[model samples]
Target: MTASYVAIVLLGAFAGGFVNGLAGFGTGLVALGIWLHVIDPLYGAPLVAICSVAGQLQTLPAIWHAVNIRRLLPMLVGGVLGIPVGILLLGHMAPDLFRLSLGLFLIAFAIFMMFNRSLPAMRWGSKKTEGMVGFCGGILGGLAGLSGPLPTIWVTLKRWEKDERRSVFQMFNLTILACVAISHLAIDGITVAFSQLVLIALPGTFVGAFAGIRLYRRLNDHRYNLLVLIMLAISGITLVVSEIG
Candidate 1:
Protein backbone atom coordinates (compact mmCIF):
# COMPACT_ATOMS: atom_id res chain seq x y z
CA MET A 1 0.00 0.00 0.00
CA THR A 2 1.08 3.56 -0.59
CA ALA A 3 2.23 5.61 2.39
CA SER A 4 -0.82 7.86 2.20
CA TYR A 5 -3.23 4.89 2.23
CA VAL A 6 -1.36 3.26 5.08
CA ALA A 7 -1.56 6.47 7.03
CA ILE A 8 -5.34 6.63 6.59
CA VAL A 9 -5.90 3.08 7.72
CA LEU A 10 -3.65 3.47 10.75
CA LEU A 11 -5.34 6.68 11.80
CA GLY A 12 -8.78 5.07 11.54
CA ALA A 13 -7.75 2.02 13.53
CA PHE A 14 -6.08 4.08 16.26
CA ALA A 15 -9.08 6.39 16.55
CA GLY A 16 -11.40 3.41 16.69
CA GLY A 17 -9.35 1.76 19.40
CA PHE A 18 -9.03 4.90 21.51
CA VAL A 19 -12.73 5.57 21.29
CA ASN A 20 -13.56 2.06 22.37
CA GLY A 21 -11.25 2.42 25.35
CA LEU A 22 -12.64 5.79 26.40
CA ALA A 23 -16.34 5.33 25.64
CA GLY A 24 -16.97 1.58 25.12
CA PHE A 25 -18.48 2.27 21.72
CA GLY A 26 -17.83 4.42 18.62
CA THR A 27 -15.00 2.32 17.23
CA GLY A 28 -17.24 1.04 14.48
CA LEU A 29 -18.85 4.40 13.73
CA VAL A 30 -15.62 6.34 13.96
CA ALA A 31 -13.79 3.78 11.90
CA LEU A 32 -16.64 3.87 9.43
CA GLY A 33 -16.24 7.61 8.89
CA ILE A 34 -12.45 7.48 8.80
CA TRP A 35 -12.21 4.64 6.28
CA LEU A 36 -15.00 6.11 4.20
CA HIS A 37 -12.66 8.97 3.47
CA VAL A 38 -10.23 6.55 1.77
CA ILE A 39 -12.38 3.60 0.81
CA ASP A 40 -15.83 3.38 -0.68
CA PRO A 41 -18.50 4.18 1.91
CA LEU A 42 -20.45 1.13 0.75
CA TYR A 43 -17.62 -1.04 1.97
CA GLY A 44 -17.84 0.43 5.48
CA ALA A 45 -19.93 -2.35 6.99
CA PRO A 46 -17.70 -5.26 6.07
CA LEU A 47 -14.51 -3.28 6.55
CA VAL A 48 -15.46 -2.10 10.03
CA ALA A 49 -16.72 -5.57 10.82
CA ILE A 50 -13.30 -7.05 10.10
CA CYS A 51 -11.33 -4.51 12.15
CA SER A 52 -13.92 -4.59 14.91
CA VAL A 53 -13.82 -8.33 15.25
CA ALA A 54 -10.02 -8.14 15.30
CA GLY A 55 -9.95 -5.44 17.97
CA GLN A 56 -12.36 -7.43 20.11
CA LEU A 57 -10.24 -10.56 19.77
CA GLN A 58 -7.34 -8.57 21.13
CA THR A 59 -9.33 -7.22 24.11
CA LEU A 60 -11.14 -10.42 25.07
CA PRO A 61 -8.11 -11.99 26.73
CA ALA A 62 -7.64 -9.09 29.10
CA ILE A 63 -11.22 -9.45 30.42
CA TRP A 64 -11.51 -13.22 29.99
CA HIS A 65 -11.33 -14.14 33.64
CA ALA A 66 -14.72 -12.70 34.67
CA VAL A 67 -16.92 -13.70 31.72
CA ASN A 68 -19.89 -15.06 33.73
CA ILE A 69 -20.60 -18.00 31.43
CA ARG A 70 -24.15 -18.68 32.56
CA ARG A 71 -25.25 -15.07 32.20
CA LEU A 72 -23.70 -14.77 28.74
CA LEU A 73 -25.34 -17.82 27.18
CA PRO A 74 -28.80 -16.39 26.63
CA MET A 75 -27.53 -13.30 24.88
CA LEU A 76 -25.47 -15.44 22.58
CA VAL A 77 -28.39 -17.69 21.91
CA GLY A 78 -30.53 -14.71 21.00
CA GLY A 79 -27.77 -13.19 18.90
CA VAL A 80 -27.22 -16.36 16.91
CA LEU A 81 -30.90 -16.76 16.20
CA GLY A 82 -31.08 -13.28 14.73
CA ILE A 83 -27.91 -13.22 12.63
CA PRO A 84 -29.29 -14.81 9.45
CA VAL A 85 -32.01 -12.25 9.01
CA GLY A 86 -29.86 -9.32 10.07
CA ILE A 87 -27.24 -10.11 7.48
CA LEU A 88 -29.88 -10.44 4.83
CA LEU A 89 -31.09 -6.91 5.50
CA LEU A 90 -27.66 -5.31 5.49
CA GLY A 91 -27.56 -4.49 1.79
CA HIS A 92 -31.30 -4.04 1.30
CA MET A 93 -32.12 -1.48 3.99
CA ALA A 94 -31.41 2.21 3.95
CA PRO A 95 -28.20 3.02 5.79
CA ASP A 96 -29.63 6.26 7.08
CA LEU A 97 -32.54 4.53 8.76
CA PHE A 98 -30.14 2.17 10.48
CA ARG A 99 -27.83 4.96 11.61
CA LEU A 100 -30.61 7.30 12.81
CA SER A 101 -32.16 4.51 14.80
CA LEU A 102 -28.80 3.95 16.41
CA GLY A 103 -28.48 7.66 17.18
CA LEU A 104 -31.88 7.97 18.84
CA PHE A 105 -31.28 4.87 20.91
CA LEU A 106 -27.88 6.15 22.02
CA ILE A 107 -29.40 9.46 23.07
CA ALA A 108 -31.95 7.49 25.02
CA PHE A 109 -29.17 5.57 26.72
CA ALA A 110 -27.60 8.84 27.85
CA ILE A 111 -31.01 9.95 29.09
CA PHE A 112 -31.35 6.76 31.08
CA MET A 113 -28.10 7.47 32.83
CA MET A 114 -28.82 11.13 33.56
CA PHE A 115 -32.10 10.28 35.30
CA ASN A 116 -30.53 7.59 37.44
CA ARG A 117 -27.80 7.86 40.01
CA SER A 118 -26.55 4.34 39.42
CA LEU A 119 -25.25 2.38 36.45
CA PRO A 120 -27.32 -0.55 35.26
CA ALA A 121 -26.53 -3.71 37.20
CA MET A 122 -29.79 -5.56 36.88
CA ARG A 123 -28.20 -9.00 36.81
CA TRP A 124 -31.27 -10.40 38.52
CA GLY A 125 -33.89 -11.19 35.95
CA SER A 126 -36.02 -14.07 34.75
CA LYS A 127 -34.99 -16.50 32.00
CA LYS A 128 -37.64 -14.89 29.84
CA THR A 129 -35.95 -11.52 30.03
CA GLU A 130 -32.63 -13.04 29.11
CA GLY A 131 -34.15 -14.83 26.17
CA MET A 132 -35.87 -11.69 24.97
CA VAL A 133 -32.74 -9.61 25.24
CA GLY A 134 -30.69 -12.27 23.50
CA PHE A 135 -33.04 -12.69 20.56
CA CYS A 136 -33.49 -8.97 19.82
CA GLY A 137 -29.90 -8.11 20.62
CA GLY A 138 -28.63 -10.87 18.36
CA ILE A 139 -30.53 -9.46 15.40
CA LEU A 140 -29.11 -5.99 15.97
CA GLY A 141 -25.64 -7.41 16.47
CA GLY A 142 -25.76 -9.41 13.29
CA LEU A 143 -27.28 -6.63 11.20
CA ALA A 144 -25.56 -3.41 12.21
CA GLY A 145 -22.89 -4.98 14.41
CA LEU A 146 -23.94 -2.88 17.42
CA SER A 147 -25.74 -5.39 19.55
CA GLY A 148 -23.90 -4.27 22.68
CA PRO A 149 -26.43 -1.51 23.42
CA LEU A 150 -29.35 -3.51 24.85
CA PRO A 151 -27.17 -5.81 26.87
CA THR A 152 -25.18 -2.84 28.05
CA ILE A 153 -28.44 -1.23 29.11
CA TRP A 154 -29.48 -4.43 30.79
CA VAL A 155 -26.24 -4.52 32.73
CA THR A 156 -26.58 -0.87 33.62
CA LEU A 157 -30.13 -1.43 34.88
CA LYS A 158 -28.90 -4.20 37.13
CA ARG A 159 -26.21 -1.88 38.46
CA TRP A 160 -23.32 -4.11 37.55
CA GLU A 161 -19.88 -2.99 38.62
CA LYS A 162 -18.05 -1.01 35.97
CA ASP A 163 -15.53 -3.75 35.41
CA GLU A 164 -18.21 -6.39 35.13
CA ARG A 165 -20.13 -4.35 32.57
CA ARG A 166 -17.06 -3.64 30.45
CA SER A 167 -15.83 -7.19 30.65
CA VAL A 168 -19.16 -8.67 29.67
CA PHE A 169 -19.76 -6.16 26.91
CA GLN A 170 -16.35 -6.85 25.47
CA MET A 171 -17.04 -10.57 25.44
CA PHE A 172 -20.49 -10.11 23.97
CA ASN A 173 -19.21 -8.03 21.06
CA LEU A 174 -16.34 -10.38 20.29
CA THR A 175 -18.72 -13.30 20.22
CA ILE A 176 -20.96 -11.51 17.74
CA LEU A 177 -17.95 -10.62 15.66
CA ALA A 178 -16.89 -14.25 15.39
CA CYS A 179 -20.30 -15.38 14.23
CA VAL A 180 -20.65 -12.57 11.71
CA ALA A 181 -17.17 -13.01 10.29
CA ILE A 182 -17.91 -16.66 9.64
CA SER A 183 -21.00 -15.77 7.69
CA HIS A 184 -19.12 -13.19 5.68
CA LEU A 185 -16.32 -15.54 4.89
CA ALA A 186 -18.36 -18.67 4.26
CA ILE A 187 -21.08 -17.10 2.22
CA ASP A 188 -19.45 -14.11 0.58
CA GLY A 189 -15.79 -15.12 0.48
CA ILE A 190 -13.46 -12.27 1.36
CA THR A 191 -12.66 -10.66 -1.99
CA VAL A 192 -9.12 -9.71 -2.99
CA ALA A 193 -9.67 -6.01 -2.40
CA PHE A 194 -11.32 -6.53 1.00
CA SER A 195 -8.58 -8.91 2.00
CA GLN A 196 -5.98 -6.30 1.13
CA LEU A 197 -7.81 -3.74 3.24
CA VAL A 198 -7.88 -6.14 6.13
CA LEU A 199 -4.12 -6.61 5.90
CA ILE A 200 -3.62 -2.86 5.74
CA ALA A 201 -5.82 -2.37 8.79
CA LEU A 202 -4.16 -5.01 10.98
CA PRO A 203 -1.16 -3.00 12.18
CA GLY A 204 -3.28 0.04 12.84
CA THR A 205 -5.86 -2.05 14.69
CA PHE A 206 -3.10 -3.55 16.78
CA VAL A 207 -1.91 -0.16 17.94
CA GLY A 208 -5.46 1.00 18.48
CA ALA A 209 -6.31 -2.03 20.57
CA PHE A 210 -3.25 -1.56 22.71
CA ALA A 211 -3.98 2.08 23.41
CA GLY A 212 -7.71 1.41 23.90
CA ILE A 213 -7.18 -1.32 26.48
CA ARG A 214 -5.11 1.10 28.50
CA LEU A 215 -7.84 3.74 28.44
CA TYR A 216 -10.56 1.24 29.22
CA ARG A 217 -8.84 0.67 32.56
CA ARG A 218 -8.77 4.36 33.47
CA LEU A 219 -12.22 5.51 32.31
CA ASN A 220 -15.01 6.44 34.75
CA ASP A 221 -18.75 7.18 34.60
CA HIS A 222 -18.88 10.94 34.01
CA ARG A 223 -16.46 10.90 31.11
CA TYR A 224 -18.18 7.81 29.82
CA ASN A 225 -21.47 9.71 29.85
CA LEU A 226 -20.10 12.63 27.86
CA LEU A 227 -18.51 10.32 25.32
CA VAL A 228 -21.75 8.45 24.84
CA LEU A 229 -23.72 11.66 24.24
CA ILE A 230 -21.25 12.97 21.73
CA MET A 231 -21.27 9.69 19.83
CA LEU A 232 -25.06 9.70 19.84
CA ALA A 233 -25.26 13.25 18.48
CA ILE A 234 -22.66 12.55 15.83
CA SER A 235 -24.11 9.22 14.78
CA GLY A 236 -27.65 10.65 14.85
CA ILE A 237 -26.75 13.60 12.69
CA THR A 238 -25.09 11.35 10.15
CA LEU A 239 -28.10 9.08 9.93
CA VAL A 240 -30.57 11.99 9.81
CA VAL A 241 -28.65 13.60 7.03
CA SER A 242 -28.25 10.34 5.14
CA GLU A 243 -32.00 9.90 5.29
CA ILE A 244 -32.66 13.35 3.91
CA GLY A 245 -30.34 12.71 1.00
Candidate 2:
Protein backbone atom coordinates (compact mmCIF):
# COMPACT_ATOMS: atom_id res chain seq x y z
CA MET A 1 0.00 0.00 0.00
CA THR A 2 1.03 3.58 -0.59
CA ALA A 3 2.16 5.67 2.40
CA SER A 4 -0.90 7.88 2.05
CA TYR A 5 -3.23 4.91 2.24
CA VAL A 6 -1.53 3.66 5.37
CA ALA A 7 -1.68 7.09 6.92
CA ILE A 8 -5.36 7.48 6.17
CA VAL A 9 -6.17 4.07 7.57
CA LEU A 10 -4.33 4.76 10.79
CA LEU A 11 -5.99 8.13 11.11
CA GLY A 12 -9.40 6.58 10.84
CA ALA A 13 -8.50 3.79 13.26
CA PHE A 14 -7.25 6.19 15.91
CA ALA A 15 -10.22 8.51 15.59
CA GLY A 16 -12.62 5.59 15.80
CA GLY A 17 -10.81 4.02 18.72
CA PHE A 18 -10.68 7.30 20.61
CA VAL A 19 -14.39 7.88 20.20
CA ASN A 20 -15.20 4.33 21.24
CA GLY A 21 -13.01 4.67 24.28
CA LEU A 22 -14.51 7.96 25.45
CA ALA A 23 -18.17 7.34 24.66
CA GLY A 24 -18.44 3.57 25.02
CA PHE A 25 -19.84 3.43 21.50
CA GLY A 26 -19.37 5.21 18.14
CA THR A 27 -16.33 3.59 16.57
CA GLY A 28 -18.18 2.95 13.34
CA LEU A 29 -19.75 6.37 13.34
CA VAL A 30 -16.37 8.05 13.56
CA ALA A 31 -14.19 5.64 11.55
CA LEU A 32 -16.38 4.80 8.61
CA GLY A 33 -16.54 8.45 7.61
CA ILE A 34 -12.78 8.51 7.15
CA TRP A 35 -12.26 4.96 5.88
CA LEU A 36 -14.90 5.08 3.18
CA HIS A 37 -12.73 7.46 1.21
CA VAL A 38 -9.99 4.84 0.91
CA ILE A 39 -11.93 1.55 0.86
CA ASP A 40 -15.12 0.20 -0.54
CA PRO A 41 -18.05 0.00 1.89
CA LEU A 42 -18.08 -3.80 1.70
CA TYR A 43 -14.56 -3.92 3.09
CA GLY A 44 -14.92 -0.78 5.19
CA ALA A 45 -17.99 -2.10 6.98
CA PRO A 46 -16.43 -5.29 8.28
CA LEU A 47 -13.16 -3.58 9.04
CA VAL A 48 -14.99 -1.08 11.24
CA ALA A 49 -16.87 -3.94 12.90
CA ILE A 50 -13.68 -5.84 13.70
CA CYS A 51 -11.81 -2.77 14.85
CA SER A 52 -14.71 -1.60 17.02
CA VAL A 53 -14.80 -4.89 18.89
CA ALA A 54 -11.07 -4.73 19.40
CA GLY A 55 -11.22 -1.20 20.81
CA GLN A 56 -14.07 -2.13 23.14
CA LEU A 57 -12.31 -5.27 24.29
CA GLN A 58 -9.22 -3.25 25.02
CA THR A 59 -11.15 -1.00 27.41
CA LEU A 60 -13.65 -3.53 28.76
CA PRO A 61 -11.77 -4.53 31.89
CA ALA A 62 -11.61 -1.00 33.23
CA ILE A 63 -15.39 -0.78 33.34
CA TRP A 64 -16.09 -4.41 34.23
CA HIS A 65 -17.18 -3.64 37.76
CA ALA A 66 -20.07 -1.51 36.59
CA VAL A 67 -21.69 -4.16 34.44
CA ASN A 68 -24.89 -5.50 35.90
CA ILE A 69 -25.93 -8.64 34.09
CA ARG A 70 -29.54 -8.64 35.29
CA ARG A 71 -30.03 -5.10 34.08
CA LEU A 72 -28.29 -5.83 30.82
CA LEU A 73 -29.87 -9.18 29.94
CA PRO A 74 -33.18 -7.98 28.54
CA MET A 75 -31.49 -5.57 26.15
CA LEU A 76 -29.09 -8.24 24.96
CA VAL A 77 -31.84 -10.77 24.38
CA GLY A 78 -33.97 -8.30 22.47
CA GLY A 79 -31.02 -7.03 20.45
CA VAL A 80 -29.99 -10.53 19.41
CA LEU A 81 -33.49 -11.42 18.38
CA GLY A 82 -33.86 -8.24 16.34
CA ILE A 83 -30.72 -8.62 14.27
CA PRO A 84 -32.06 -11.18 11.80
CA VAL A 85 -35.15 -9.08 11.33
CA GLY A 86 -33.02 -6.02 10.60
CA ILE A 87 -30.95 -7.99 8.12
CA LEU A 88 -34.18 -9.06 6.46
CA LEU A 89 -35.47 -5.51 6.34
CA LEU A 90 -32.25 -4.33 4.75
CA GLY A 91 -33.28 -5.94 1.50
CA HIS A 92 -36.60 -4.11 1.37
CA MET A 93 -35.85 -0.71 2.84
CA ALA A 94 -34.66 2.38 1.02
CA PRO A 95 -31.52 2.73 3.08
CA ASP A 96 -30.71 6.29 2.15
CA LEU A 97 -34.13 7.58 3.12
CA PHE A 98 -34.09 5.59 6.31
CA ARG A 99 -30.71 6.96 7.26
CA LEU A 100 -31.77 10.47 6.41
CA SER A 101 -34.81 10.27 8.64
CA LEU A 102 -32.88 8.75 11.48
CA GLY A 103 -30.20 11.36 11.12
CA LEU A 104 -32.68 14.18 11.41
CA PHE A 105 -34.22 12.57 14.44
CA LEU A 106 -30.88 12.19 16.16
CA ILE A 107 -29.96 15.80 15.49
CA ALA A 108 -33.25 17.09 16.79
CA PHE A 109 -33.17 14.87 19.85
CA ALA A 110 -29.63 15.76 20.72
CA ILE A 111 -30.31 19.46 20.41
CA PHE A 112 -33.44 19.19 22.51
CA MET A 113 -31.67 17.25 25.20
CA MET A 114 -28.78 19.66 25.24
CA PHE A 115 -31.03 22.66 25.76
CA ASN A 116 -33.70 21.27 28.05
CA ARG A 117 -31.90 21.65 31.37
CA SER A 118 -35.01 21.10 33.41
CA LEU A 119 -36.10 17.88 31.80
CA PRO A 120 -36.69 15.18 34.35
CA ALA A 121 -35.08 11.78 34.09
CA MET A 122 -37.40 9.25 32.56
CA ARG A 123 -38.26 6.54 35.05
CA TRP A 124 -41.19 4.86 33.35
CA GLY A 125 -39.28 2.34 31.25
CA SER A 126 -38.86 -0.96 32.94
CA LYS A 127 -37.09 -3.98 31.49
CA LYS A 128 -39.73 -4.44 28.77
CA THR A 129 -39.21 -0.95 27.46
CA GLU A 130 -35.49 -1.40 27.62
CA GLY A 131 -35.91 -4.59 25.60
CA MET A 132 -37.83 -2.72 22.94
CA VAL A 133 -35.09 -0.13 22.77
CA GLY A 134 -32.58 -2.90 22.43
CA PHE A 135 -34.68 -4.47 19.73
CA CYS A 136 -34.65 -1.23 17.75
CA GLY A 137 -30.94 -0.88 18.32
CA GLY A 138 -30.34 -4.42 17.00
CA ILE A 139 -32.37 -3.74 13.90
CA LEU A 140 -30.40 -0.56 13.33
CA GLY A 141 -27.18 -2.37 14.01
CA GLY A 142 -28.13 -5.08 11.55
CA LEU A 143 -29.39 -2.67 8.94
CA ALA A 144 -26.86 0.11 9.30
CA GLY A 145 -24.25 -1.05 11.78
CA LEU A 146 -25.79 1.46 14.18
CA SER A 147 -26.78 -0.26 17.41
CA GLY A 148 -25.59 2.21 19.98
CA PRO A 149 -27.66 5.37 19.47
CA LEU A 150 -31.04 4.16 20.66
CA PRO A 151 -29.77 2.39 23.71
CA THR A 152 -27.42 5.24 24.48
CA ILE A 153 -30.28 7.68 24.31
CA TRP A 154 -32.42 5.46 26.50
CA VAL A 155 -29.74 5.13 29.12
CA THR A 156 -29.17 8.87 29.08
CA LEU A 157 -32.86 9.44 29.65
CA LYS A 158 -32.73 7.08 32.61
CA ARG A 159 -29.94 9.30 33.98
CA TRP A 160 -27.69 6.49 35.08
CA GLU A 161 -24.29 7.59 36.29
CA LYS A 162 -21.49 7.76 33.76
CA ASP A 163 -19.89 4.43 34.61
CA GLU A 164 -23.19 2.58 34.68
CA ARG A 165 -24.25 4.17 31.42
CA ARG A 166 -20.93 3.47 29.83
CA SER A 167 -20.82 -0.10 31.04
CA VAL A 168 -24.28 -0.95 29.80
CA PHE A 169 -23.96 0.58 26.34
CA GLN A 170 -20.40 -0.54 25.91
CA MET A 171 -21.28 -4.13 26.74
CA PHE A 172 -24.39 -3.98 24.59
CA ASN A 173 -22.43 -2.53 21.69
CA LEU A 174 -19.65 -5.05 22.12
CA THR A 175 -22.10 -7.93 21.87
CA ILE A 176 -23.85 -6.45 18.86
CA LEU A 177 -20.60 -5.65 17.09
CA ALA A 178 -19.21 -9.11 17.83
CA CYS A 179 -22.30 -10.65 16.27
CA VAL A 180 -21.88 -8.40 13.22
CA ALA A 181 -18.24 -9.36 12.83
CA ILE A 182 -19.05 -13.07 13.01
CA SER A 183 -21.84 -12.71 10.49
CA HIS A 184 -19.50 -10.93 8.13
CA LEU A 185 -16.87 -13.59 8.66
CA ALA A 186 -19.40 -16.26 7.82
CA ILE A 187 -20.31 -14.55 4.58
CA ASP A 188 -16.80 -13.43 3.66
CA GLY A 189 -13.96 -15.30 5.21
CA ILE A 190 -10.97 -13.23 6.18
CA THR A 191 -8.56 -12.71 3.33
CA VAL A 192 -4.83 -12.27 3.77
CA ALA A 193 -5.17 -8.62 2.82
CA PHE A 194 -7.89 -8.12 5.39
CA SER A 195 -5.66 -9.55 8.09
CA GLN A 196 -2.88 -7.21 7.06
CA LEU A 197 -5.13 -4.19 7.29
CA VAL A 198 -6.21 -5.31 10.73
CA LEU A 199 -2.61 -5.49 11.84
CA ILE A 200 -2.04 -1.95 10.66
CA ALA A 201 -5.09 -0.79 12.57
CA LEU A 202 -4.43 -2.46 15.93
CA PRO A 203 -1.71 -0.19 17.25
CA GLY A 204 -3.62 2.97 16.46
CA THR A 205 -6.74 1.48 17.97
CA PHE A 206 -4.96 0.58 21.18
CA VAL A 207 -3.26 3.92 21.56
CA GLY A 208 -6.37 5.95 20.84
CA ALA A 209 -8.54 3.84 23.11
CA PHE A 210 -6.17 4.28 26.00
CA ALA A 211 -6.07 8.02 25.50
CA GLY A 212 -9.83 8.21 25.35
CA ILE A 213 -10.29 6.10 28.47
CA ARG A 214 -8.02 8.45 30.36
CA LEU A 215 -10.20 11.37 29.37
CA TYR A 216 -13.30 9.36 30.21
CA ARG A 217 -11.99 8.80 33.71
CA ARG A 218 -11.56 12.51 34.25
CA LEU A 219 -15.08 13.50 33.21
CA ASN A 220 -17.85 13.96 35.77
CA ASP A 221 -21.30 12.49 35.09
CA HIS A 222 -22.70 15.75 33.73
CA ARG A 223 -19.76 16.30 31.44
CA TYR A 224 -19.95 12.76 30.13
CA ASN A 225 -23.64 13.17 29.44
CA LEU A 226 -22.97 16.30 27.46
CA LEU A 227 -20.17 14.57 25.62
CA VAL A 228 -22.49 11.78 24.53
CA LEU A 229 -25.11 14.23 23.34
CA ILE A 230 -22.54 16.15 21.37
CA MET A 231 -21.21 12.99 19.81
CA LEU A 232 -24.70 11.93 18.84
CA ALA A 233 -25.26 15.28 17.20
CA ILE A 234 -22.05 14.95 15.29
CA SER A 235 -22.97 11.42 14.28
CA GLY A 236 -26.27 12.71 13.00
CA ILE A 237 -24.54 15.37 10.97
CA THR A 238 -22.18 12.78 9.55
CA LEU A 239 -25.05 10.57 8.48
CA VAL A 240 -26.91 13.41 6.84
CA VAL A 241 -23.85 14.57 4.97
CA SER A 242 -22.93 11.08 3.80
CA GLU A 243 -26.41 10.39 2.52
CA ILE A 244 -26.70 13.70 0.79
CA GLY A 245 -23.24 13.57 -0.72
Expressed as tens digits, the lDDT of each residue in 1-245 for candidate 2 is: 88888888899999999998998888888887788788666788889888899999999988999999999999999999889999999999999999999999899999999999579898798899889999999999999889989998998888889999999899989999899999999999988878878898878888989999999999999999999999899889988988998
Computed on alpha carbons, the lDDT of every model, listed in order, comes to: 0.71, 0.90
Q: Model 1, range 1-245, lDDT digits (tens) per residue?
A: 68898789878988887666555556776787778778866566667767777787777776677678897887777777877777678788876677777767766665656677555445468867776786777778777776767776676566555667666666676677678777667777778878888888877887888888887667675565455556655665655666676
lDDT of 1: 0.71
- Per-residue lDDT, model 1, residue 59, is 75
Regions more than 4 Å wrong, model 2: none
Candidate 1, TM-score vs. the true structure? 0.84
Where is model 1 more than 4 Å wrong at Cα?
A: 88-99, 118-124, 221-238
TM-scores for the candidates: 0.84, 0.97
The candidate scoring highest on lDDT is: 2
Local error of candidate 2 at 105, Å?
0.5
